[model samples]
Target: MSDSLCESVDSTNETPSKKTQLEDGSDSLSVIKKAVVVLTRLPEYKISALRPPTPQQFYSEDESHSSSDSDMEWEPEGDSGDSDFSVPDNKQKTGKPTQNDTTKTLPPQTSTNNDSVSEPAPIIISSAFAYCANEITKVRPNLPEEEVKVDMMVLARKRHMRWQRGKIVEIITREDGRLKYKVNFVEKGKSLVSGHHIAFDTTPKLEQLYVGARVVVNCQDETFRPAILAELPSRKNRLRFLVFLDDHIPVYVGLPFLHLVCRPLENVLDDVPDSPHKSFMSRYLRDWPNPHLTQYKAGYILNAELNGVQQRCEVQEVDSSLIHVVFKDNQHKEWIHRGSIRLEHMARFWELRRVQDVSD
Candidate 1:
């Protein structure tokens, strides 16, 4: 028995192993230890030795507890079993847990918070451009609406192309995309022609190809045969046009529709007098010049007949794409490279009313 537990009631202080004693239970010290344990005070939690007193029992023991009602922490005097800090408030008592942890359990997609939304729903891709077998039937215009396309090329913008056979016309496309088309003009072969460009690879619409914007799209309507550019990543073969080739002149040939800008070189032949072309021009085509080279009906050269007779008359200019030369009597006037002729030629003939001018 421990001397410290001589007056205490707890049994743990006095229980000693039997081995600690000599084999006999007759030791006087062992008897004294048991007596000391029984006399000492026991812990209050030991159910066999003691039990907790009720609040009323405690108050009965001490009158000071009943007088101070505010001394109670969780429960006040008047409000029995009521607590101010307890959970489940009126606003949060609904089926759903309104705590921050519960709100976080909902998926972000279904969140009602507008600020959490990042992007609008994606748009579904529906209609698109499609490649079709070329039709050879020539679609003639009512022939009443004949207009010229100067600044822009309608065929290049729509990614459509046109070709002609003996008596049939063909239309082709380079890519599959949405389109709105109608027959615009018809030639001898009678191909269904529209003022649309042959769309190259997947590209934006004509509305997106704004002015001053660079674009590359394949040529689908240029010919009936399979185009080589259709196999490349960008179907458009590169065509470079400068609004200003040098210090002057605005050009427009680099687009999908490549038209050779042309003007008549007919004049009084001030430089070359008594030239064959200047003397007899009517006998040749006997027609006015075509402003654009591709639209020209025929080609001619000034040649002298055997007896002082001439096939051309004294004219200003003739339509030769590589060289806009005029042989008034018999003299070379002017010429340009096929690459740089669009705006240069257009500025001189159509706009300025001057062709074969060595002065400027």
Candidate 2:
């Protein structure tokens, strides 16, 4: 019994010591965890304190400098309370500009005036009649009557049994409800004519005034004289033409002063009746073939068919299979098959013109 009591006491003492040691170890581990947390937090605090300034802060500094350096002594144009800060009047007396002042005083922003900038002029296309396999229909003499208005220029059949240029001066309604126009022929006097005797004045195509064609030219003396077109107008010659008058007098006339009389199919040289003027004109009449016949190249103008209708097109690019072209009439771009292009031929051109003249 004595031995059992001694052993029990010793066990109780040892258990208390072990409990104390475990409690101390737990406290030391908690302290070490707290120290680790503090060490990590210290670096974050230092980094935040050393951070660079924000953009707003830099802008505020620039604003302060601008306020001090501006020469104008006026306050900002707004409610004083709305502004974050105000410039003192004393700062304005410096009369010196800061670096920011140069930027502020820079020339006012300029905008392009689209109206003042002129648009590029449209491409002026020379007109031509395309050769058609089908026959051209004639302009019917007894066609449907058209409505006429005052001050409209028209073709009126007057004294000479030929169509003459006239202007519609007045309108007359007959008892039968038929309308007659008081046509004022510039050369002839005014007379009343029915709608059947009047037609709209149409401008002839430039192709009809080709070189070697017959036309009546208004001479310098303002007299309309018979002449043969010696040379077509070109950019080099200021768009004027060289013509031989009936008396074999050569003259340069503007396009507006010439009227097409006829386009003969035969060579112009054949009709010249062997004279010095005829020999002089032969130099201009040497049948020049279409330039593109040798090779298709960029910027060359040629007759091309688009959607089965012939139109003048400027060549943009040429390849083995397709040719890129832009239509002169509407500026429409298209890729045309090589076969669709009709290169102009001198003999064929005159033949087509003859057919058109007969149809008209």
Candidate 3:
């Protein structure tokens, strides 16, 4: 029986070789039928000409100027080294050290004092010119012997906001033993600092000109129409002043937008106030100027003109040059020429007095 089973298995294997050949023949015939069907469906009509769409039809003005994500080119935002980890000079905030952070070593220490504590060199700011945070370093006139150890940021003049009278709100000591101050300005509040100085005297330089200081906004073209300094500039380099005509109307001016003339007082003693009263016009006028003249048109400022001399006017209404104004003598009249309006250089214009100078 075993022998008979073995013979049957051998016969079965020998007979199966034609089965694969039959399946291959069937697949070939199916492929041929599909090709014939596709050829019969080809269109007999001619196709229309194809052209790219016009830019005007497809794209709006804004879409053409802007780029899409797929079309944008990729580039590194900044360098991979210390630049990434470095803090801003105004407000230094360090990033955690990573493998990519550029490591920098502090400069070799020089001991300025007997104590072991490291002291950064003293930066002596020259008071020759009115200074704000960003102005370039000029030779600090008058003090040649003292070496001013300026902050690296100040030397670079990287911080450009000028705080003419910026007041220090807070002082911070950095981990690296550097000192930085937070300054605030009246015109533009809290900003970063690049340069700072310590004034020995609490009194401002402008305080000396009590009632007689005649000054103008240091405008371009010497249109230098006079504007009374309203208040001393903040510890930041900001200055606010006012323009007043005969009616004693006060128009406030802000800076660094309004550049006031800082040329040396031809006479330093001129700005000193003669009387206790703060208003410069009070000393001369028998009748106080009408305060109501201060109310101005929604867009137009009431300016005065005496001759052909014109000043920089920041008014919106420009149809006519002539505007009604009051004079120092308390006269109200309309001047034909806007250029003729004259701003007076009144001493102690705002009448601010130093605390120490006050008489009880």
Please provide, for model 3 over 25-117, each residue's C-alpha lDDT reduced to its tens digit, 9 standing for 90 to 100: 563222211111112222223111123455433654322221210111122233422111111122223323322112222222354434344
Model 2 shows how many backbone clashes? 0
Candidate 3 regions off by >4 Å? Answer: 1-216, 222-227, 231-240, 244-252, 257-280, 283-360
For model 1, residues 240-298, the per-residue Cα lDDT tens digits are: 33222111112223344322111101221221234333222221112211112111111
Query: Which order, best to worst by TM-score?
Result: 2, 3, 1
Clash totals in order: 46, 0, 40
lDDT of 3 at 234: 26
In candidate 2, which residue ranges exceed 4 Å CA deviation?
1-203, 263-265, 269-273, 287-360
- Two-way TM-score contest, 1 vs 3, winner: 3
Question: What is the C-alpha lDDT profile of model 2 across 236-259, one tens digit per residue?
Answer: 223556566645555666667776
Clashes of 3: 40
TM-score of each: 0.14, 0.25, 0.18
Model 1 lDDT-worst window of ten: 228-237
